[model samples]
Target chain A: MTGDTELRDRQAMMKAALQAYVDRANAGDADGLVALFAPDAVIEDPIGSPLKTGADIPAWFADTVAFGTRITPVAPLRGSHANEALLVFDVEFTPPGGEPMRIRSADACTFNDAGLITRLRAFWGPGDIEPA
Target chain B: MTGDTELRDRQAMMKAALQAYVDRANAGDADGLVALFAPDAVIEDPIGSPLKTGADIPAWFADTVAFGTRITPVAPLRGSHANEALLVFDVEFTPPGGEPMRIRSADACTFNDAGLITRLRAFWGPGDIEPA
Candidate 1:
């Protein structure tokens, strides 16, 4: 494929991967979510939080799935000219020993050539959280 | 102030800078837009596009203003725990000799301690654009 065509294909693939992330998260499929990430992937949920990589990734998603997190996209998935995608969504989840809450989140994800997410940085400050 | 308090303040500053970006772009004030960026700021509009920095930054905004671009944010400005913020907006601009066009865009910006934008990467693939 031509360079332009290759980039276009990559954009499509990145968007598709983002959709799969949402679907898998909503399904409470921690393994499925983990599968979408590269082995060397790094995740910083809420940006300021600690990074999750290697085995920490699976553990993080396990906790995520246990929280019963559900993602509802507020805007259409956005793709870049490069190998990155953005997802703007509202997430509802039950916090440990607390009532369910909602947070407005925008996740910026970068993917490798293999289409696996290599880095994920979620943007959602404390002000974004509210009672669901 | 405490570290947490400092970070919170930074987040607020970042969000305000993003609002300024939208307002300045809509007002066609290239100088104002340029001022919000750090001296060493780098911008990649549409991600895959060429990077604009130093003198190129001003020229890029000059063309942006020349295009008569107006930004209408579709979502609230989202802040991160770190020095980053996201703005999802729809842009209406007139290309040279072409009719007005609309493009759905999501910009991720990283700010410096002084609240100036240090880096900006916009997400908007070909499919995200359409006739205005």
Candidate 2:
């Protein structure tokens, strides 16, 4: 494949993966959500949190599912010319020991050549989260 | 300063800089827009395009100003735990040899410790652009 076509293919894959991510999360399917990541993927939900990798990933998503999290797209999924895609969404969930809250989250994901997400850095701060 | 406070300060600066970016762009102030960048900043306007830096930065904004680009924030500016912020906005402009168009762009910006934008990678694919 030409380099240009290959790049576009990668971009398409990343975008599709982002949509799948939302679907899986909304469906509360922790396994499906974890499957979107590479074997050695790393994630920082809310950016400032500790990194979650390997076994931490599955556990993290399980917590997310347990929180009854629901993600709603705020804008169209953004794809870069490279192996990155941005998902802008609003999340509503109740965290442990916390009230129901809505968070305006923008996840910046980097994908591997195989289109599995290798890194996900979610952008959200204390100010972005508000009581629902 | 404690690490937590320092990190929060950086996050605040990044988020403010993003709001300034939107304000400068909407006001058609190319100079103001360029001032937000660090001296050695780099930008990729559509992710797939060539990187603009140094002398190219001013010229790129000049073209942007000439196009009368109007930026409207679609979602609240998102701040990370680090020196990064995400700006999700819609741009309305007329490109050379093209009709008026609106692009849904998500700019992932990395900031220097001094709060200037050091790297800006905009994520927007062809499908994200629509006739305005």
Candidate 3:
């Protein structure tokens, strides 16, 4: 395969991996969500402190699920390079006693040669979310 | 040039252009700094509203100069794509009657085929700068 072809393939794999994680998060499947990350993956949540390693992803997902948050991946994942991809999506969170609030978020993911996500950096505007 | 070589050359040009702007800004050379942007360039400042043309950049720079801000571009400009670059740097501002405060900023710039910056978006932590 040509370099361009390889880069495209890598980008596709990265997108699929990110989609899988989002799907699991929306479904409240903590195990499936955690499985998407590499063993040494790092997650920097827009709120709270950063989580290093895949082991911490479950707790992070649990917190979101507990808040009844559902994430929808938006179209056209913008990639900066072959091994790096940026995914933008909208997420809706429903508090236990309040209405649902929608927030737009963009995540930057890095993949290793094996196409496993090694790092996930999430970006979101603080004003995008409102108290319910 | 090979694809890799071409990409490197483009990155170098971008770095030089950004450095020129920073140097001009530090020297309060408004005209020289504004020349780096395309006529239809857009600038999204970290605070307040966004500017949507090269003509607006002069006003933005003047505001910074009035604030007595000096910007330093850090090394290793990270490029996501061949035509796009992300620059992370630090800026220090001194108020008229107060001490100096430093803020770290990251800018994402897009270049047109002519190598002129068509868009410049600045990003910085809200807490990075302290009231002086």
Per-residue lDDT of model 1, residues B16-73, tens digit only: 8999999999999999999999999999998988898999999999989999999999
Each candidate's fnat, listed in order, reads 0.70, 0.67, 0.00
Over the stretch A1-132, how does candidate 2's per-residue lDDT look in tens digits?
A: 227678778878899999999999999999999999999999988776788899999999999999999999998888876777899999999998889999989998999988899999999876687898
Expressed as tens digits, the lDDT of each residue in A25-130 for candidate 3 is: 8888877877777788888655223455555677777777888878776534444333666556678888667788876555667788787888876654333355
Q: Chain B, model 2, TM-score against the native? A: 0.94
Candidate 2 colliding pairs, count: 0
**Could you tell which candidate, 1 or 2, scores higher by DockQ?**
1
TM-score for candidate 2, please give it. 0.92
| Cα interface RMSD of each candidate | 2.7, 2.9, 17.7
TM-score of each: 0.95, 0.92, 0.49
Q: In model 1, which runs have C-alpha deviations exceeding 4 angstroms?
A: none
Where's the lowest-lDDT run of ten residues in candidate 1 chain B? Answer: B1-10
Chain A of model 3 scored by TM-score = 0.81
- List model 2 lDDT by residue over B1-132, tens digit each: 227778777767888889998899999999999999999999998886789899999999999999989999998898877677899999999988889999989898988878999999998876678999
Ranking by lDDT: 1, 2, 3
Q: Is candidate 1 or candidate 2 better by TM-score?
A: 1
Candidate 3: tens digits of C-alpha lDDT, residues B33-115: 77888888888655223455655677776767777778776534444324665555678887666788876555667887677
Worst 10-residue lDDT window for candidate 3 chain A reads A123-132
Candidate 1 residue A19 Cα shift, in angstroms, is 0.8
